[model samples]
Target: MAKRKIRGTEEAWETGELGRDEKYVEVADINESTIDEALELQMISIRLQKSLIEDFKLIAKINGIGYQTLMRQILKRFADSETKRLLRECVRAEEQEAKEQRQMEEIEESRKRA
Candidate 1:
């Protein structure tokens, strides 16, 4: 492995290859009317108990939002949380497997030496 000197160039930055400064941008004036519509959605019909729907509606009313919107938020939050947890577990399992593999390799090398 050899260390190499890297050349720095200002052409990439000075030529406006990067976007213009948006530090003074106003978000409230932005036309995002169709932003919600732009998001992909799938429609699926499901059967739910009346009590559940009533509970969801009550919660939604308290939150000042529609029940369906509240449901979507809850589902998205649960899914995102579970995804992060699963990813962490997967990484831990992979690290443990790699550690075991390295230990086995060391043991095999010692056996060969014997």
Candidate 2:
């Protein structure tokens, strides 16, 4: 067996062999809920066009990730961007409204002085 050095570590291990401190655990007893909880994931289902799914699968294969994971990442990015955009719009609207209110107050004060 060939020895391989782990990246960013001072440890070396033999390729194609388990370390003395490592052992494989039996996975037969593990269930979906256990995995979801460990990964902090929630299960969801949605229907999409077959063509879209196929496209995602091809892209994900090229990127070395599952299609579902790619879709989740895409959704997260869109949500974050959309939330920021909406927040900016809200701030602009609030600022305009405050400016209009100040203008109205100034007009009323001028009318009272006249």
Candidate 3:
């Protein structure tokens, strides 16, 4: 097989001779978990409205990305913002509880002194 530079714009690619110089190797010990870990990706499935999916596809095309990638980005952003908001609410509640406890302690101390 002759090794030639592969060009996408060439007419010869349509003749199905593009990969003639390519080499193929088989791996006997492939681990899916290792591949997923290396890529930091997890597979998940969820059902969505067909209209929602069509909207995403249009928006993704306008943004020059696949709809799935756009969905992932939106999910990530929502999760991050929601996590932060929940954490802040939790902290505020804890602070308010602590303040009320201190106020009760002050009232008890005043009663004891009287």
Candidate 4:
């Protein structure tokens, strides 16, 4: 793709615009990628009353983020944190205790089938 110089009209620097500079810029081809992950079960059901929906939109607009994108990022971050915490706890569990006992029992049961 070819690159071209673009002048910034005053409207480009409007309030709540993200990463806006006062000077004109030369824009190149935009490179963006979408995440591809297996679909998981939906976990949340949200009910937004009229006033609450309005307030949520207001907050999102002020922060210069799309409401849906903001929510997706927030949930992804929280889930990542929770998964890390659970993994850490699992790694710290006692090998000579309940975990070892459970593993031994499973092996014994498998041997009986053979």
Candidate 5:
């Protein structure tokens, strides 16, 4: 029989499974005593609007994530980081389009004059 190598410690086994082609996470099995010690310090509650709840559900479906998990990922991803970049690209493309349009108009005007 072939021996299988275990990761971390004997308390856990790790394997890979496709999560609706979205992403991967590591799940671990730890001693209940350890968990109890970790949970002693905090309690937090957050509220969300109904419409935003529905939109989050839709995004979670697209990303193959549970609603809560999707929310955590979004918060951690710092969603606004790309806004300035995308806006700059959009403005540059619009300017280039306008310049090309003016050039074409000038060419038509020259043809009319000829």
Candidate 6:
């Protein structure tokens, strides 16, 4: 069996000071005034499964966004997909109706010639 590498000591893990790397620059006080407020947000409360919420938080953290923002993005994508699907179905239905109408007109013309 391969030996697994142990993580940092308890003290380092607890203090969360693992000697900051030079590559990681700490940022503070970003001015978001330039950002456009295109959408008016409303606050609402809802219940979600604990595990699902945890997964959302983990994914949001990975993407460097808040969980609520991630959820909104996900919802928007789903809504757009559903809207496209409905539009395609409507177009197909209209095409089918036009095809049937053409077929009926051909049958009527043949009857008139007979």
Candidate whose TM-score is highest = 2
- 1 or 6: which has the higher TM-score? 1
As for lDDT, the candidate ahead, 3 or 6, is 3
TM-score of each: 0.64, 0.69, 0.68, 0.39, 0.35, 0.63
Expressed as tens digits, the lDDT of each residue in 10-98 for candidate 1 is 87457754444587555675445455556655666999999999999999999999999999999999999999999999999999999
**lDDT digits (tens) for residues 1-114 of candidate 4:** 896655465555465253455464576564332222234434467876888667667878999988766677777899999999998887778554787899999999999999
lDDT of 6 by residue, 1-114 (tens): 997654678876567555455667777554454233335455579899999999999999999999989998998899999999999999999999999999999999999999
Q: Rate the local accuracy (lDDT) of all candidates.
A: 0.84, 0.88, 0.90, 0.70, 0.76, 0.84
User: Which is better, 5 or 6, measured by lDDT?
Assistant: 6
Q: Write the per-residue lDDT of candidate 2 for residues 3-111, one digit (tens) a residue.
A: 7854543343455334444366444888899989998899898999999999999999999999999999999999999999999999999999999999999999999
Residue-level lDDT tens digits of model 5 in 51-72: 9989999999998889877886
True-vs-predicted CA distance for residue 75, candidate 6, Å = 0.2
Name the runs in model 4 displaced over 4 angstroms.
1-55, 94-114
Structure candidate 1, residue pairs in collision: none
Write down the TM-score for model 6.
Answer: 0.63
Q: How accurate is candidate 3 locally (lDDT)?
A: 0.90
Q: 4 or 6, which is superior by lDDT? A: 6
lDDT of 6 at 71: 93
Better of 2 and 3 by lDDT: 3
- Candidate 5 differs from the real structure by a C-alpha RMSD in angstroms, to one decimal, of 11.7
Residue-level error in angstroms, candidate 2, position 98: 0.4
- Candidate 3 regions exceeding 4 Å error are 1-35
Count of backbone collisions in candidate 5 = 0
Task: For candidate 4, list the clashing residue pairs, or say none.
Answer: none
Winner by lDDT between candidate 5 and candidate 3: 3
RMSD of 3: 9.6
